[model samples]
Structures are given as C-alpha cells and as structure tokens.
Target: MTLTLTALTSPPARVDLSPLVPETTRGRSAIEVAGTAIRCGRDRVGVGELFAVSGYGTDELVLRGELGRIDRIGAGMRGGRLRVEGSCGDHVGARMTGGEIVIDGDAGAFAGAELRGGLVRIEGSAGASAGAGYPGTRAGMSGGEIVIAGDAGQEAGAAMRRGLVAIGGRAGDGAGLRMLAGTVIALRGVGAEAGMGNKRGSIVSGRPLRPLPGYARAVRYRPPALALQLRRLRELGLEVPDAMLTGAWTRWAGDRLELSRGEILIFDEEEVAAG
Candidate 1:
C-alpha cells in the first residue's frame, strides 16, 4: 500500500513532518496517520489539518503540493520510499538511516544533513549545507548518498564524515567545508574556497577550479576510483562523459591546516579533449 498526502496550503513557518514517514505510518489507519502530530510554528497540529491523507499500511509514501516550509520530511527513516512531487523546504531528509527519498523539485537548505544511510535524490537545485552536520556535532552525513541534478548552494557537503554527494551542476563556495571524510563530485564549476578546512575527504571537480591557498597540488594521474564512481553515477541516470570516466586528474592535497589527508581532484581538460 502507498500513502498519499496532498498539502492544502503552504505552511506559514517551518513544519517538522518527520513523524509521518513510513516507519510510523506503516501499520496505522488513515485516520491514525492523519492524526500524527507535526510541529508547525510553535504549535503542534495533526497532519490531517494540513494535508489530505489517503491510503495507509504501506512502506511507500507520496507527497504532493508545495512544501517549501516543511522541514525534516524524512528524518531518521530506516526503510521504505518517499517521493515528493513538488518543492520541499529545509532539512528534507535529515539523519535518515535507510530508505530512499526522491524530490522532483528544488529543496531548501540542509536537504540531507546528518544522513546516516539511504539515498536522497533531488531533481532540482539544493540550498546550502545540503549534507552538513547538526549544530554542535562534529560530523555530518555519516553515510548515504545525495545526488543533486542541479546546482547546489554553499557548503554542499560540510562536515560530512562519510558517504557520497554528487552535484551535476555548479556548486557554490565552500562545497566541502570542514569535511572529515566522504566524496563530493561537482560536474560543473565550483566556487572559491571549496574543500576549506577539510581533514580527510575527496572533492572531484570536472570544471575549472582555482587552487585554494590552503591546498597544494600533488600530482596528475588517472585514479581507478574515478572510473568506479563515474560508472555508479551513470547507473543513476547521470550523463557521465567518456572523458570523465577515463581521464587524468590533477590531485591537490591539503587544507594542511587540519589532518592534511584531504584531496581535491581537478579533471585535466587537455586529457578530456584528447579522450
């Protein structure tokens, strides 16, 4: 069974809808599911008051309408699938340990912050801190994968401890800020100061990127890891060019300010053209 929720009105303030995921709604009746409390502004309200809920007792959930103020849509989900047909607000899939969340439109800030496992795919752009850590925490996005088909705002993978974040479009400044571990692949250009303060991680840029002062170019070579990752991206329906899959990449290692194990790989245009 698949549950469907259609929002009747745009939320006035941030609404935490994490309580309505498959884990909590799987065995409940429509009335019970609708009665689930959601945080709206300073008050708690039944989901039935905000959206029309239909179907129940399933692991699949479909949500429609504009949810630009809905936060924590799939927080801590361990299994099942959630599909959003319209734009979603901040923290779309924060701390989800498993399952899948697909957003057909744009997502606001912290789209996948603190994710532990699972897959989150955004067909449109994402706001800042897409895979960042919670406030006061040392790590963000300990696991899972986030695929942004459009541009990503600043700090796309900030403080991520593990997992993968692939952006098919340009990434704003601070793409991998303070990243401890993980991989961030930006297909288009990346803004200044990417990989800042990174301790141990990999930032692969397919477009032009000026070397940051905190980094130092190490070498130029074709890494086997790039081929494997590109293949995975291709499986996700992302167009990974032949050159990118089999090209020499310039490796720059630094953010020497930290543990110094972090690396930034910039694709060599000349190699791309030759390929």
Candidate 2:
C-alpha cells in the first residue's frame, strides 16, 4: 500500500520530511516511520509527533495538508512517486535520481534544486531559484525535469548542468541566469536579464525578451526541435498553444562574456504581426 502522512497541525518551524522516501523507509514499519527523527529548525522531533503516519514501506507516498512549512519532501529518492495534496515546501524533489513528485499547489524556493533524474510537476506557481544551484554548489539540476503550470521566480534555471525547466507562465528576472547546459521554457514571458551569463543552454520564450547585453541575433524560423519539445510538454498535460507549437522563432546567440554557446529563442515578432 502507498504510504501516507497527514500533518496534524501547522508547524512552529519548517519540518523536514526528506527521510520518508522509499529508500530510507524500505524495511521500516509504520511504527518505525513514526520513530524516524525529523528536524524542526534547530531541534529534532519524531515524525509521529507532527504527522499521522500509515501504511509504511512503500515507494508511493501521499502527503496531505498545507505543507508549505515542510521541507525536502522527496529529497534523495531513487524511485517512486510522491504526491503533495497542498502547497509544498522548498526542495520538493532535490537530488532525486528517479521518480515523480507532483505538488498540487504552489511550491517554495529551489523546488527541484540539484535533481539528478526524475520529474517534479507543480500544478501551481513556484518560488525563486526554481531549478537553481545551491549557494555553494557547482551545478544545479544535473539531470531531470521540472514542470510548473504557473509562474516561476528569479533565476528559474540558474547554473543548471542538464535538465528541462518549463514554466507555463511568466518568469522572474534572470530566468536562465548563469546556466551551464539545459533547456528553460518560459512560456508567457520573463523579467530583466533573462539569460545572463549562460554558457551552453537554451531559453525558449513566447514573449519578447528585454534587450540582453551579451547577445546577437542569429536567425528567425520555426525550429523542429522546439516543436518536438512542445509535443512532449503536451503529453505531460501542460497546455501548448497552437501559436507556440507552430510559430516562427528568432534565435539569439548569447552570453558572449561566457562560452556564447547558449541561445534564446523568442517567438518571432514578424510572425505575430502577420497573424
């Protein structure tokens, strides 16, 4: 049976639920799960004190309640599914090697930081540094996919080595700031300095981007590769407008101060004027 944890009340400090994943609780019973030590700010507490746990030792986990104060819901999981019924905490699926984590509501900062493999799908908006590297980390999200149905905060895919971060709505400043290599899809729009210092990644946008300093326009055409990626997004149940799926895009080679291999593809202004 799928394991379930229901929060008893709002926490005084952030509660860490990262230990409840399949790997850590593989052989643990419900009682052992209850006994699992979880951190709350500077102190440690037992899981049973804060949550009503049930059906232990399963790869599939369901968390219920307003989990915004909870942290690392699916950290370091190798496989399985984790579903959050309400708004979730930071690092929802950080460092997961494989599996899927679905957050039904908004997610906090660093939603999928340093993810290795797997998918983190948020049905609502996400906070800053959605797929970014930690303060001292070398790279962010080495591999994986993070799909947000609504807006995303600043530096959405910052310093990512490899992965896909798709934001369905507008993104904050520096959407793909300092990206190493990856694909960042900001559908509606993005704030200032969208692709600053990017090395070898792609930032795809539906709206016109503000003038980026280290960029030079390359070409304007509909890219077949982008259409394929749009199709994949549709398969994941995210909306892909017809114009977005089959529109002409203007490619700009960017971040000249860096490797200059990164590209930003904006929906062509000419195409929009013609339509």
Candidate 3:
C-alpha cells in the first residue's frame, strides 16, 4: 500500500492517519510501504503534496518528506514499523501502544506525548514534553521507549509514571518534572529544576548539575542497568558514546515534597579521568 502527500494548501482542522486503514499488521516480513496514502488536515489535501511513497513490504513503513506540519503520523499504532526520512510535526506517535517509530530528522513538540507502549526514535532534536502526561492526567508513558538524538525542550518527561526516555544530547529545563516512576537518561547536561518533584524515578546524565535544593547526595556507583539501555539505543541506530556506557555516577535522592523515591545520577568527572 502506498499514499503520496502532494501538498498542504492550508492547515486543515484535524488530520487523523490511524483511521485511514492499513494494509497489514502482523508477520515478520519487513513491510516496505509509505505514508503517502495518509490524509492531512481533515483530508483536505493529499499526502502526495508533501512526499513520494514507494516500496511495498510487510514489516516497515517508510516516509520521505519535510513533514514539518503533518501531525499524528502514527497515532495509536499497535504493530509494525514507521520510519520518517525527515523532520515531523507535533504528536508524531501519540498514544501508540505497540510497534516502532524511527525518525531520521528532528521532531516537533510532543514527539511521543502520552506514549503507552513501543518505541519512538528521533535522530534529531525534539520539542517540549517528549513523553509527558496530558493536562489533568496523572499517568504518562506507562510503557515504551523514546530516544532523542539531539537536544530536547522543556519538561522532557513530565509526570511520567513508567517507561524510559534516553536523550543523546542536551535536555532543556524542567526535565523529569513531577516524575512518578521510570528512567530518563541524558548524555549531555540538563537544565535547572530537573527532578524537581520526582517521586519514584531515575534521572541520569553524563554531566554535572546542581542538585535540587531538597535533594541529598547519595553515593557514587556504576549502574548496571545503563549498560542494557545503551545496548538498546545502539540497536535503534542511536550513537551512544563509549565514555557514557562505562562511567561512574554520583547518585542523589530527593523531592521530599513527594515520596523521595526518585534519584538523580550525575556522572563523575574524576571517574572519567581515571578511566
């Protein structure tokens, strides 16, 4: 199955791609299809206006375009694979429960907002709230994995209840704000107010950061789980630096305002020197 995005004369009210029907969902064979068949902005415009679709397989869905305004490219996706050739708009994979989404370029805000299961991988930067709960909702990202290759905007994992978020680049302020449980790993430095009100989660970074006012220093140790995470990211085609995979980190516990179960792990420069 193939659909081509021709153009977007004007932004339609809403464009839902999941309802357009799919060719297949099961089987191990790679589904080599494209998103040119999906409609945009209330089906006001054809997908051909934005991209060209080719190839026909079973396990993969490839998209080629700028795709800066096409939202909900894979909403509620249950199975299979989605690969974007370029940057994408908001809600790239909103509420997806299963399958995989791979982006070769940057992603707009809410790239993986409210993701329930599966994996979303971005080779470039992402906007605010990569895996955050919706307004008034208590849970975010119950399961799944989000990998950002570049810097991220504010509140990267706000109010998250479960799952994992790994950033290969810098992260903006308010990261892990109000986190309930889960893991967030940043390869570069993170901004202020990180882990501000976290309860039962872990925020790990490769750089130093001033611990939040209420947080207390714990100890220095090398977490073994990070090794598994690095391997997973590598399998997704993300570049994980060697130093980060084999480094010691300073652990801190805090957010007394909540359960105080969450922790922030900052890499130790001295350990890196020794290695």
Candidate 4:
C-alpha cells in the first residue's frame, strides 16, 4: 500500500514534519494520519490542517506540493521509504539510522547530517553541509551515502566518520573537514581546503586541485577499486562519464596538521562541469 499526502496550503512558519514518515503512518486511516500533530512555530497543527491525506499501506509514502517551509521531513527514519516530491527545508534526513529518503528537488542545509545507515539522494542542488556532523557532535554520516546531483554548498561532508558522499557537480570549500574516515567524491571538483583536517579519509576530485601545503604529491596510479565504485554509482542513476570510469588518479596525502592519513585523489585529466 502507498500513502499519499498533498499540501493544501503553506504554513505561516516553518514546521517540523518529522512524524509523518512511513513507519509512523503505515496503516493509519486518512483521518488518523491527518490528526497527527506537527509543530509550526510555537503552535501545533494537525497534519489534516495542512495536507490532503489519503491512502493506507506500509513501507511507502509520497508527499506532494510546495514543501519548502517544511523541515525534518524524515528525521530519525528507521525503516521504509519516504519520497519528497519537491524542494524542502533544512535537515531533510537528519540523524536517520536506517531507510531511504529521496528528494526530487533541492534540499536545505544538513540534508543528511549524522546519518548512521541508509541513503539520502538529492536530485538537485543541496544547501550547506549536505552530510556534515551536527554542531557540538563528534562525527557526521557515520554510515550510508549522500548523493547530490548538483552543486553542494560549503562543508558538504564536514567531519564525516564513515560512508560515501558523492557530488555530481562542484562542491564548495571544506568538503571534508576533520573527517575521521570515509570517502567523499566531488566529480566536478571542490573548492579550497577540501580536506582540511581529516585524519583518515579519501577525498576524490575529477578536476585538478591545487594541493594544500601540508600535502605531498604521491605517485599517480590507476585505482582498481574506483571502477567498481563508479559502476555502483551508475546503478544509482548517476551518469558517469566513460572517461571517468578509467583513468590514472593522483593521490595527495595530508592535513599534516592532524594525523596526515587522509588522501585527496585528483584525476590525472581534468574533468569539466558547470555550477
């Protein structure tokens, strides 16, 4: 069964829509689903007041309408699938431990912050810190994947401990700040200080990156694992250029300011992309 909710109107203030995930309303009646309460500014509003709810099922949910002011669309998701039809506000999948959240449009800041498992795929551009650690936290996106089809704002994968963050377009500055482990791939390229203080991680760039002074140019070689990874990306619907599938990548290891175990891999041939 598939549950569908269409927005009837926009909220006056940003609202927390975290409670409407598939796990919570799987078999609930339309009225029961509509009766769900969500916080809007200081007051609370029923889901029915804001959405035209219908359907009954388990494992799938479809949300429609102009949902830009809604926040935490799938925060803390444990299981099932949630689909956002259009753009959404901040924290689209914050702190989720399991399940999948697919955003057909842009997502605001912290799109998948602190994700432990599962996948958050953004079909459009993502705001700052797509998979970064939450403030005052020790790690970000401990497991899982966050894929942005368009450009990503600053600190796209800040302090990531594990998982994969793939940016199909250009990624802003500080792509992997203080990362302890994991992999970040900015296919188009990345900005300054892409891997500032990572202890152990791999930051791959399709375009040439002027390495930070702390980094030393390492041998250029063709990575045997990248082909498999790129093929997986293709299975995920990302269009991987044929040339990107096969090439010699230059590895630069650094952030000597930290453990000096992190590496930034740059493709031998420059890759071109738009903003």
Candidate 5:
C-alpha cells in the first residue's frame, strides 16, 4: 500500500505529526484503514483544509512537495518504509529503531540524531551533527547505519557509541569528536581535528592528514577489517572507490589525552607499489 501526501499550501505553523498512525505491530493490528491523508494544520484548522490524502495501503508512505517545516517525519519509527521526495526539516529519523528511510533531497540539522537501530540513507547533503548524540545525552547512534551521499556539516558522528557512518563526500570539522566506539569512514577529505579526544573508534579517510603532534605514526599495514567495512558500505549503495578498497592505509593512534585506543587510517599510495 502507498500513502501519498501533497501539500495544499504552505503551513503557517509547524505541523505536529505524532497524531498520525505508525506502522507498529500494535497499530497495524488494530487499524483496518490502510491509508491516510494529512494537510497543514492551522489555528483551529482540520486536515481537510490543507491537503488531499489518497491511496489505500500500508506498505509504503510517500511525501511530495516542499516540506522544509515538517520536522520528525519518521521519528521513532519501528517498521515500514518512508520516502521523502523533497527536502525536509530537521530530525527526519530521530531515535528510529527500525525500518529504512530514503531522503532524495537535503536534510536539516540532526538528520539521524541518536538513531538506535535501522538504516537511513540521504542522497543529498546534511546539516550539522548528522548522527551525533542529542544535547545532554551520553550516547549517539548506539546502533544502525547512516550514509550521507554528499558533504556533511560539523560533528558528523560526535560521541557515537556503536554503528557505522559513511560519508561519500567531504566531512566538516570535528567529524568524530569524542567518539567512544564506532566506525566513521569519509570517502573524501575530512575537516580539521577529525577525531579529537576520541576514546575507542576507527576514523578512516581516503585523503592525507596532518597528524596531531601526540599521534605517532604506527606501522603501515593493510587493515584486515577494512575489506569488511568497505563491503558493508557498498551494500548500502555508497560508491566505494577501487583504490580505497584495494589500497594500504597509514595508521596513526592518538588523542593521548584520552584512552589512546582511537586511531585514524589514512589511505596511502604506497600499497599499490608494495603489492
């Protein structure tokens, strides 16, 4: 089943989408209705005043027209697929624990903030803190995966405890700041202070880096786990360059200020000759 949403007019106030039924096990069990329509909510306004809802099914949900103000499109979703055909506001998949979300356009700040499980793929760029922990929260993205096809803003994966984040384009400053455990791979160059104060995690970059003074150059070796990581990225529809998957990486361990278990792997050209 497919539920299509077309905006009738620009919403005067931010619409609250919590009232919409979800595809949870209990919700699907109770509601016999397969599809629903929603429109911009105004002061004392009903859904009929805004947009027309059509379709009768539960398998798919599609959103059309501009949605720059519709926040939390799929918040805490546990099942079903959500497709956003246009750009959306912040918190597209906040704390989502299951299902898949594909955004065809750019997303606002905190795109996948504190996602616990499931997969979120963004075909366009994302704003700051793409997969970082929420403010005052101890953990960020404890599970699941986030793939950004374009450049990302600051603090891409700050304080992440688990899961994988792959940025297909360049990443902004503080890419993986204070990460406890997880994997962050940037296919393009990462911003300055890529992994500052990281405790235990891996930050892999496809470009060279100006290693911090405290980070000593470790032995250059082909990481056995890199093959698996790249394979996972490929499965997510990210373009993994042949050079990256087949190249050797220069390992630099640091943030001596912390556990010193975190390391950054910079892909090196020497691997081709050594092979």
Candidate 6:
C-alpha cells in the first residue's frame, strides 16, 4: 500500500514533516496517518488539516507540493521509501539512519546533514552545507550516500566522517571544507578553496583544477580505487564520461596546515586523447 499526501495549498509557514515517513505509517490507517502531528512554525497541526491523505501505509510514501519552506521531510528514518515531487525546504534527510528519500526538485540547506545510513537522491540542486555538520558540531554525515544530479552550494561535504557525496553539476565555494573522511565526487567544475583544511578524505573532479596553494602535485596515474568508483558510478546511471573511465588523474596531496592525508584528483582530459 502506498500513502500519498498532497497539500491543498502551501502551508502558511515552514512545516516540519519528519513524522510522515513509511516506517511511522506502515501499519496505520489513512485517518491515523493524517492524525500524525507536525509542527507548523509556532503552531502544531495534523496532516489531515493541511492535506487530504489517501490510502493506508505499507513502506512507501509520496508527498507532492511546493514545499520550499518545509523541513525535515525524512529525518531519522530507519527503513522504507519516501518520494517528494516538488521542491523542499531544509534538512531533507537529516540524521537518517536507514531508508531512502528521493526529491524530484531542489532541496534546501543541510540536505543530508548528519546522515548515518541509507540513500538520499536529489534530482535537482541543493542549498548550502548539504551533507555537512551543524553549527558548533564537528560531525557531518557519518555514513550513507547523497546523490545530487544538479549543482550544490557551499560546504557540500564539510566535516563528513564517512560517506559518499556525488554532485553531478558545479559545486560552490568551500565544497569540502574540513572534510574528515569520505569521498566527494564533483562531475563538473568546483569553485575555489575546495578541500580547505581537509584532514583525510578524497575529492575527485572531472574538470580541470588549479593547484591550491596548500597542495602539492603528487603524481598522475590510474588509481585502482578510482577506477572502481567510476565503474560504480556508471552503474548508478550517472553520466560518467568515457574519458573519465579510462583517463589518468592528477593527484594532489594537501592542506599542509593540517594532517595533509587528504587528496584531490583532477582529471587530465589531455591524457585521454594522448592515449
């Protein structure tokens, strides 16, 4: 059974829709699902009052509307599938331990912040600090995968301890600031100051990159791990260019001010033709 929630109108204020997940509604009736309480700005309201809920739940959910201000759409989910048809507000998948969330439109800040497990796929762009830690916290997505088919805002994977963040389009400044451990793959160009103060992690870019002042060119070679990642990415339906799959990458070891174990791999398109 699939539960569908369509908003009659955009809520008057930002709404917290974290409770409307497949795990919570699995055994509930439509009426019970509607009765699920959610915070709307300073007031609390039931889903029934804001939208017409149809169908009982059984591990699948769909939310449709212009939800640019809504928050926490799938926070803390342990299992099941959730899909949003329109743009959404912040924290689209915050602290999720398991399950899958798919956003067909753009998502706001903290798109996958603090994700522990599971997969979050955003078909459109994401706002600042996507998959990053909250203020005053050193922890970001400890695990899981976030796939954004479009651009990403600043600090795309800041403070991530472990996980994979793949951005198909351009990334804003500070793309991997303070990264601890994880992998961030930028399919297109990345902005300046990427991987600043990164202690241990990998940032891979298919576009050309100027060597940052804190980094030193290591070598140009085909890393086995990178080849494996490219294959996996191709299987995931991401447009992994043919050049990247067989090309050499220029590795730069950097952030000398820190542990300097982090590395950045910039694809050398010239090598593809040379070969």
lDDT scores of the candidates, listed in order: 0.88, 0.87, 0.75, 0.87, 0.76, 0.87
Candidates ranked, most accurate by lDDT first: 1, 2, 6, 4, 5, 3
Using lDDT as the measure, the top candidate is: 1
| TM-scores for every predicted model | 0.96, 0.95, 0.84, 0.95, 0.87, 0.96
Worst 10 residues of 1 by lDDT: 266-275
Ten residues in sequence with the least summed lDDT for candidate 6: 266-275
Off by over 4 Å in 3: 1-15, 20-57, 271-275
Candidate 4, residue 195: Cα displacement in angstroms equals 0.6
lDDT: which is higher, 3 or 4? 4
Tens digit of per-residue lDDT, candidate 5, span 1-275: 46566667767866644334247322332133323333344544454444445554475667677778777777788877888897877887878888888899988888888888888899999888888888888788888898999988998888888988888998888888888889888888688888887888788888777665546677677888987899889988889888787778888887788888888888867532221
How would you encode candidate 3's per-residue C-alpha lDDT over 1-275 as one tens digit per residue?
53323223434444545532133422212222232245565454444444344444455666665567667777788777888788878888878888888888998887788889989999999999898887788878778999998998999888888998889898899989889998888888788899989999888877888878768887787778877877777876667777767867788887888888889988866733211
Query: Candidate 5: which stretches are off by over 4 Å?
Result: 16-51, 270-275
Q: For model 6, how does the per-residue alpha-carbon lDDT over 1-275 read when each residue is reduced to its tens digit?
A: 57888887888999999988888989889899888889999999999888789888988899887788789999988899999998899999999999999999999999999899999999999999899988888878899999889999998999888998888898888878898989888889678899998889898888887746787788888888988887777665578888788888988897787888999888976733211
TM-score of 6: 0.96
RMSD of 1: 2.5
**Candidate 1 on 112-217: residue-level lDDT in tens?**
9999999999999999988988678888989999999999999989999999999988888998898999999888867889999999999989885776778887
Instruction: Report each candidate's C-alpha RMSD, comma-separated, in the order given.
Output: 2.5, 2.2, 4.7, 2.9, 4.0, 2.5
Where model 2 places Cα greater than 4 Å from the true spot, the runs are 269-275
Q: Write the per-residue lDDT of candidate 4 for residues 1-275, one digit (tens) a residue.
A: 47888888888999899988889988788889989999998999999998998888579888889899999999989889999999999999888888999999999999999888888999999999989998888788899888889889999889899998888998899899888889888889899988988889889888887877777777678887777777777887777788878888888888889889989888857532211
C-alpha lDDT of residue 96 in model 3: 86
In model 6, pairs of residues that clash are: none
Window of ten residues with lowest summed lDDT in model 5? 25-34
